[model samples]
Target: MISVQGLTKTYGGFRAVDDVSFVAAPGRVTGFLGPNGAGKSTTMRMMTGLTVPTSGRATIGGHAYRDIPNPGRHVGVLLDASAQHAGRTGREVLALGAGVLDLPRSRVDEMLETVSLTRQEARRRVKDYSLGMRQRLGIAHALLGDPEVLVLDEPANGLDPAGIHWMRTLLTDYARRGGTVLLSSHLLHEVEVIADDLVVIGQGRIVAQGTKTELLQSTGTVVRAVDDAALERALAEAGISSVASPDGARRTEAEARQVGEAAAHHGVVLLELRAADGAGLEELFLTLTSQTQREGAAA
Candidate 1:
């Protein structure tokens, strides 16, 4: 299991990660989610000891990442697939990692095969590999030691549909075999399909964390009307508060039926109404982090 307790990182006066805490339990896939500049990468870096935290700690199996001798054997990490040396072959890259981990050279070949890289492909220089191929190579390197925990950042960045499906199956099987998996991604749909638990971050802090079902059930409802002003007034008069959404307004207390009744009672024309229970992850993420987005400067 991976545990993060009050982990924080600061640069100058900026807080890159602020007292973030979450656990990636064994036999489960935890999706680390956030928008651009939400500090997902910073948190992952702290967990791996790649970046020292200003406070708190991240541990694997009760030991800090730096204190774990032969850490690759306990935790596999793939923070940047493109960080590999461009001149080296995929096989060479895995071979170096195996040497560092003191694993037999045969393990390198095993990992290459495990990641579906053909012998020919493994021999080619990394500079010539496609982004998907590089991602595959990176995953193979991470798994070469057969670690109990896996931390991957944007593993599906360049994958096609088939490759993405393969990754889903691979990670799912790994978790089933008792491995802890923490996958970070901005793609809500992909994470929704595979993650058992979710840790959502915004502005360097955790905004939500729970099982997929628990989080989805917590979202209220979405409603719209022909006259949005009238619908808003009706909802207000009925004591149900709502928040603005792209399509309309969403409420945490009222269900679609309740909102529809209010609209009818107030003589407001109802155009759209739906319970947000088990709503798409995209909707949940957008709603949860609406105010935390780093808006680009106007051109």
Candidate 2:
């Protein structure tokens, strides 16, 4: 398991990560999400000990990452797929990693196969590899030690649809075998499909974190009327509160039936009325982080 408790990182007056806490439990894949500049990378850096935190801590199992012996054997990390040595062959890269973990050289071949990097491709220098190939090589290196925990940041960045599907299957299977996976990505749909839980961050703080079901479950009804002002007034008179959604529709905690009745009673022309059941991760992510994005845009 990975436990991050009140992890905060500050550079001068700027707080890159602030009081972030979440758990990536064993046998589960936790998707870490945030918009641009919302500190997703910073938090991941802290967890992997790439950056020092101003306060709090992050640990794998019960020990800090730095304290773990041969950490690659216990926690596999791939924070940057393109950070590999440009002069090294893909095979050479994994070989060096295996050496660091004191694993047999054969482990390099095993991992290359596991990530679908053919022998011919692995023989080429990393500098000549395309982004997708680099991603495959990075994943191969991460799995070289067969670690119990995996922390990957944007592992799907350069993958095609088929490659993305392959990655999803691989990580899900890894978790099924009782390993823990913490994945950070901007690919909302991919995350929605594979993540068992979610941690949403904005402005350097955790805005929300929970099982995917709990966070994505419908909280209300979404309705849009030809006369939006009239609909709002009607709902207000009925004591049902509502907020305007990003798309100009009104979302209310009341049931769809209740919203419909109120609109009908007020002679409001309804254009759309539905339960918010399938809003999905994209909507939830935007709603949770919208304020931070607006602030960022303003600045």
Best of the candidates, lDDT: 2
Residue pairs with backbone atoms closer than 3 Å in model 2 (clashes): none
Write the residue-wise lDDT of candidate 1 on 1-299 in tens digits: 99999999999999989999999999999999988889999999999999999999999999999999999998999999999999999999999999999999999989988889999999999999999999999999889888999999999989899999999999999999999999998778889999999999989999899998888775577776787778877987987766566656554446777888888899998766776656678777876676576652110
What digit string (tens of lDDT, one per residue) describes model 2 on residues 37-93?
A: 889898888888889899999999989989999989998898999999999999999
TM-score of each: 0.86, 0.85
TM-score of candidate 1 versus the correct structure, residues matched by position: 0.86
What TM-score does model 2 achieve against the real structure? Answer: 0.85
Q: Tell me each candidate's RMSD, in Å, in order.
A: 4.3, 4.7
Candidate 2 regions exceeding 4 Å error are 221-275, 294-299
How many clashing residue pairs appear in each of the predictions shown? 0, 0
Question: After best superposition, candidate 2 residue 260: deviation in angstroms?
Answer: 14
Whole-structure CA lDDT of model 2: 0.89
